[model samples]
Target: MTNALTITDVRKTYKNGTEALKGVSFGVRGGEMLALLGANGAGKTTLIGILCGLVTKTGGSAEVFGVDIDAHPEQTRSMIGVVPQEFNFNIFERVGDIVIDAAGYYGIPRSVAAPRTETILKRLGLWDKRDAVGRTLSGGMKRRLLIARALVHEPKLLLLDEPSAGVDVELRRGMWEFVVDLNAHGTTIILTTHYLEEAERLCKRVVILKRGVVVQEGEIAELVRASGAKNLEDFYLRV
Candidate 1:
């Protein structure tokens, strides 16, 4: 089967000689949930930013489905969705409006985006708060709102950055279920997270990065066995 996302010899370096990604390469197949694990400054976010077209790469190539991201950015992005680590919505805007506007940015008409917004908000348990200002919602709600905004256009690939960070355990688990359901329905998911346990449970494959280089990549179970470690945390430490 063809991959939903692909990267080849990707590299990124800042002007001050800071290397965020060093010759990274990977591919994520359709219907797969791949976990990108790394410590701080390990280039995980930089890699994700490049894939989402938020950051320009210094070298190498990336493709979504079969379309080159650099050569056909708009076409590639139309088939991709991203939920960033930080909230980037207007504070005073109504929750529904925020999602609707985001969908519009993707070239989705209001008539089409409105129903999707309503369904996503309701599914993520944010429907009741739809009319509330963004600032008035709780942290978890805000996170869900961001996710809902990302899904408003129904992209084929979804990139989630630290989906469970700072949220309560219950809410975290709920988000996992939501993600799993989305994947079961055939959306390719690529997640960058610090929570090894969550990655172990939710991702079939895992990639570990250290100092902007890929140190490990394999099926989660295979990686754990090969490292002679009982869990992902232990394997990560050994790396």
Candidate 2:
């Protein structure tokens, strides 16, 4: 089967002499849930940025499904959905309006966006809060809203940047179930997260990055066994 996403010796460096990704590479399979693990400044975000076209890479190449990321940016973007680490919606806007407007930007008409928005919001447990402004929702609700906004357009690949960060355990587990269902339905997901347990639970494959380079990449179980370790945390430390 063709990979959902592929990167070949990807590299990124800023004008200020900061190297974000140093010749790193990996590929995610179609319908797979993969974990991208790293510490702060591990180039996880930069790599995501490069994939999303938010940041440009200085060297190498990447593709979504079979489309070249750089050569067909618009086509590549249309195939991907990104949930950033931060809440990016307008604070004062009604929750439903935010999602509807996003769909409109994607060229989805209001008639089509309406019911999709309703279904997505309800599925994520945000329907009751639709009339409320974004600022009024709790942190977990905000995170669900973020996921809802991302899924409103129904892209093929989803990049979630710490979707459970700052959330309570109950809500975090709920989010996990939702993500699992998403993957089960064939949306290929690549997640960047600090929570090792979450990664261990949800991902079949893992990639470890350190100092802008890929230090390890393999099946989670294989990586743990190869490191002579008990678990992902231990294997990650060895990386």
TM-score of each: 0.98, 0.98
Model 2, 1-239: lDDT tens digits are 88999999999999999999999989999999999999999999999999988998999999999899988998999889999999999999999999999999888999999999999999999999999999999999999999999999998999999889999999999899999999999999999988998899999999999989999999999878877999998889877
**lDDT for 157 (candidate 1):** 96
lDDT of 1 by residue, 124-143 (tens): 99999999999999999999
Poorest 10 consecutive residues of model 1 by lDDT?
A: 44-53
Top lDDT: which candidate number?
2
- Count of steric clashes across candidates, in order: 0, 0
lDDT of each: 0.91, 0.94
